[model samples]
Target: MNRKIVEAANIAINNLLPTKSRSLYDIAYNRFKKWCAEKNVQLYSENVFLSYFSENAKNYKSSI
Candidate 1:
C-alpha cells in the first residue's frame, strides 16, 4: 500500500479505537475496508469515512 495511505488508515483506525480495543477494532477495520470496496472509495480518504459514517451511523449508533 502507499505509505501515505497506510499512515492515514492507521491514524484513522487508531483515532477511533484505543489499544485495549484491538479485537473489536479488527471487526470495524474489516467493515471499513469492505465498505470502501463496495463504494469504490479510497480506504484512507476522509470523505470516504465521512460518507460511511454518515450512512451507517444509525445502524452503528455513532454520535459522529
Candidate 2:
C-alpha cells in the first residue's frame, strides 16, 4: 500500500512538472515524503501535495 501510494505520488509529480523542473521536483518530492514519514504525517491528498511542493519551491527558488 505504501509503495503504491509513493509510486502514485512519483507519477503525479512527474506528470505535473515542467521538463526543466524535473530534477528539482524529484529531489523536493523525495525530501517531502521523507519529512512526512519522519514526522508521522500523511501526504496522500492533493492539498498536502500542493503544500509540500509550494514550500519546497519557495526554498529552492530562494537558493538560486
Candidate 3:
C-alpha cells in the first residue's frame, strides 16, 4: 500500500505538471509525504485522506 501510494502520487503529480516544473510538484508532494509520515496514516486510504484534508486543506489552499 505504501509503495502503491507513492507510485500513484508520482503519476498523478507528473500528469498535472510539465516536466520542467516538476520541482514545484516535488516540493508540494514532499509536504504531503511528510504529513502522512507524521500522522502514521496510509497515504492512499480514503478515510485517512479525507480526515487529513479536512484538517489541513486550508494550509494547502493558503500556499497556492
Worst 10 residues of 2 by lDDT: 55-64
Model 2, position 27: C-alpha lDDT score = 92
Best by lDDT: 1
Please report the TM-score between candidate 2 and the true structure: 0.42
* Candidate 1: Cα lDDT at 42: 57
Ranking by TM-score: 1, 3, 2
- Is candidate 2 or 3 superior in lDDT? 3
lDDT of 1 by residue, 16-42 (tens): 867789888799889988888887875
Q: What lDDT does each candidate get?
A: 0.82, 0.79, 0.80
- Taking every candidate in turn, the Cα RMSD to the unseen true structure, in Å, is 6.9, 7.5, 7.1
Off by over 4 Å in 3: 1-16, 60-64
TM-score of each candidate structure, all chains considered together: 0.56, 0.42, 0.52
Q: List the residue pairs that clash in candidate 2.
A: none
Candidate 2, 1-64: lDDT as tens digits: 6999999999996689789998998897788789778767764788777777787677676535
Measured with C-alpha atoms, the lDDT of residue 54 in candidate 2 is 80
